[model samples]
Target chain A: MEPAEVEFLAEKEPVTVIPNFSLDKIYLIGGDLGPFNPGLPMEVPLWLAVNLKQRQKCRIVPPEWMDVEKLEEIREQERREDTFTPMPSPHYMELTKLLLNHASDNIPKADEIRTLVKDIWDTRLAKLRLSADRFVREQETYAKLDNLTLMEINTTAAFFTESLNHMYKLRTNLQPSEGAESQEY
Target chain B: MADELELFEQGSDAGSDEVLLTPAELIHQLEEAWLNEKFAPDLLESKSEIVECVIEQLSHMEENLQRAKKGDLKVSIHRMEIDRIRYVLSSYLRSRLLKIEKFFPHVVEKEKLRAKEDPSALSPEEFAFAKEYLENTEMFLKNVTLKHMPPNLQSIDLLKSVPQPNLDSFVFLRVKERQENILIEPETDEQREYTVDLEEGSQHLIRYKTIAPLVTSGAVQLI
Candidate 1:
């Protein structure tokens, strides 16, 4: 049964309902399902409903209440295959070195180590924000790239995709050092 | 009061280490605080004080979430959102720390070589660059604010909107946008249709920006 049926069962029965085992399981997102899949009683696969467009074969059954074009645009973005380019930030080399060194040796000052890594992470992010802001600020200049000899728009997209990938990688890598805080209930 | 004391004792019990509050429970606590403020002001010093205490505990929890990322602490999946927001807020600060750590070797090298030199010997450009660097870093961080609708937005009728396949995503607005009815299982000819009706005054705060993102194949719906 789909996530909805399982959620309904959860309410009525108050028992943990695991999704029917499908050998040909669709990997919604990468990594082990350990964190997300804790049976029905906890998370009722809200992502399955919200993360609709990302599904391989499922088409979005549009609601009758909102704009159709907006829905389509979101779907298109979800399905879009972005080209990757390595837009290494200036500080990427420095940050990697620091992380490698610290991870190698058990740093005594955990807070200090966290602070150091975070600063580098922010620097890269700043460069990314600045780039986006610049594009908006100089939209005329950016748009004019279409007419120019060089393909500046493609370059900008490449830069953004690369920067974002690096930022995400840095985040995932750095995540291991930082302790988990029980901020919620 | 006796039950409350019992619960406190139960919470610290070695066998009951698994005992933890659910998201619903946390929301209820906030609601209790809000209710206490409105109708039972004398029951507590103030509502804001209780909320502040909750927020403070949440902030501490956020820190632990960060540490969890480092493999230093174990975290359950449910608490991820709370941690995610905290990380988003502190991302800039973390980035600043990272920059310092990354450039430490260079800084140390420069310092060692220049140790014999006088502090005033450095040119004004060097000092200005240092100041500009710090300021830019701070500016970049201040901009990274959380933009998503907070969990509190779903507070009013959180339970009513249960997740069900073909369960209508359209709640506040009219039933149909462009299509006749939203199809949950189009191939199987299964569909759940509902009309959207919205309140007047809530339009300023809440309106159909877009249909909630649909999840699966054959899950077709109108805006």
Candidate 2:
């Protein structure tokens, strides 16, 4: 999957936004949103929050986990753990970029949070690479990937899968009678 | 089926106790289907019911919005929601088309092999598209190269020429329902095959062939 597609899916995650303009409860096909009273906070999807922020119609409340203190702790915990640590949000990486890029003013210590998130991302990626190398080197057919998020998986999906395919093809060629490729097709 | 997401409320068929799937839950299912089709190596069974329901929902929302004033904020929010849902709907259909174009022969063959009582893997329109694509491809091959070849070589097996989806490819997925003792086949002869139990909500990286049934049954989801 393309990184943009992962970001697209992330955009659907709900975020809290305080709309400046008052509006009645809007019934959307996916469900309902708003009943907007000016200055009161309500939950809206990230896509809408960004749209409203661009028009200066709302102040996005950076999600609870976007705080610098919380993220610093997360980064520390991530570095300490060999396996992936549970993320504050499933799309934490995408959410940070989206929120920080569009509405930095709403979030406190935006720069610090950005750096912290980048640190956590890099740390997790290194662990992912190490594990992937082990998986390949060991020629393991199955692996439990608990706590790995979609964006994390997508970063190496294409190259990793292609290499595995090539290795499998080469391995299978040695066992010519068991041509698994032609069996199903 | 509605229980698969675990985000829905509440009913089953015990004589007219119809499951009340909210519009939100229906959209969730459509999105799941979209992602599954996108990641899956092979074409999955067509979710025509979900496709039709989503289309109906979108049009119904649009119709309601038609009566509202242009500058109305509610109208704008509704429109934005409509656009978002429409994007998912189109992307879902487009991805299916891409797969069909890649494996037209296999897709059509699967459709034929399906039992009469079973649902088709392709929607009616997609079935037509695959059939036509196959014929056009053969005709093009014949016109361009096959005609000039020896008579004995003129007849070609499209199936042999086309590549099939690699079922052995590893995929990232999350379990929806807990399963016990799923056997994981070894990649090489020296390796011993073993079984692993799947716990609900945990993710895994495994060969597609090992969990193809889980994908179709909605027990596990491709990430």
Candidate 3:
């Protein structure tokens, strides 16, 4: 789901409504990088709040049109079936990176974003550690093979491909926005 | 969903699209607050303890309302992103799980084939590969499920503490679930709970039941 879409629902109520001043507003209000401008410490908690919320709602399927009630049902069903798994969507993963990139450079919310990255990892530690151990064993297994059947090679190859993608997404989503992308703010 | 930012940009009725703060307005508010002594007091004293307490109650109710309307948007998104990764991993696991489960059957089949004079001799290399595959596959699966670690272990770190107000508002989420009469005790009053079904990853907003709007048609607060 798009951040804008998420923001739309968040905005429906007035109490939590955040103002929508543009970038120009940032310059106008925060003021130019002048001596008088009191550089505010980043709102680390706010950014963390956003990212952590994303992690809490991680599910196994993409949310194309499913509502909250339907999504919960799906979660419950998957749990009952013992097939529930958690992974990140490639599309949102990219957006998350975009968010990180933007936050690092432009948004003063970098501290909060940093906290968020830490939080997501905390929630998925079990899964991540398991994945690491599995990878080590797979490498050892693959090395022992002298002559392999077509099927054996195919299976190993597929596993590697999947593992690689999973790891990439995890790293991108879980990594903090620091020196990787240089944003002057 | 329409990009909330664009809605803020155009300033026309975003057709139900809402934004946290118009970037400009938020920044302006922040600047104004800076000009005032608000930050000084917040910095000097413990960070707005009283305000934080009030907010904690407010946010709990707010989170419930939002979740009911949007059906836990954050979780929904995380789950979908996970699907792409899970697809590949699940297939790999199924194949390996099946292979392991059929290990004894395969051995018997090979023996039977040999007895029939259809010698499908298995090489040492083949034997080793099969054994290694199962061992590693099992290891990998266990790690992903956190079977090796405590189930409730704080596996991932949170970006921020849950807003206290958001927590307070969360009572509304429960109201949707049971539909039982919400018990509102003065000391430990729980707000009404509601649940929204998101079959197609779609949801709408639910106006909060308890607390009235705070900002009331004024410029948004920067902090």
Q: Could you give candidate 3's per-residue lDDT for residues A25-110 as a string of tens digits?
A: 11111112111112322221122224423443111111231223433443444335422133222122223343444334333444
Q: What is candidate 1's lDDT per residue for B114-139, written digit by digit as tens?
A: 64422321224333443455455435
Interface RMSD per candidate (angstroms): 24.8, 5.3, 27.6
Q: Model 2, A1-185: lDDT tens per residue? A: 89999998999999999989998777777777778889999999998899999999999999999988898899999998898989999999999999999999999999999999999999999999999999999999888888888999999988998899889889878454333334232
Model 1: residues >4 Å from true position, as ranges? A1-185, B1-24, B32-45, B70-80, B83-223
lDDT, residue B200, model 3: 20
List runs of model 2 lying over 4 Å from the truth: A174-185, B1-19
Predicted structure with the largest lDDT when compared to the true one: 2
True contacts kept of each: 0.00, 0.67, 0.03
lDDT of 1 at A33: 32
Total clashing residue pairs per candidate? 64, 0, 75
Higher-lDDT candidate of 1 and 2: 2
Return the top candidate by DockQ: 2
lDDT of model 1 at position A3: 30
Q: What is the C-alpha lDDT of each candidate?
A: 0.29, 0.86, 0.29
User: Model 2 — TM-score against the truth?
Assistant: 0.92
DockQ of each: 0.02, 0.52, 0.03
RMSD of 2: 4.1
CAPRI band of model 2? medium
Distance from true position, residue B187, model 1, in Å?
A: 56
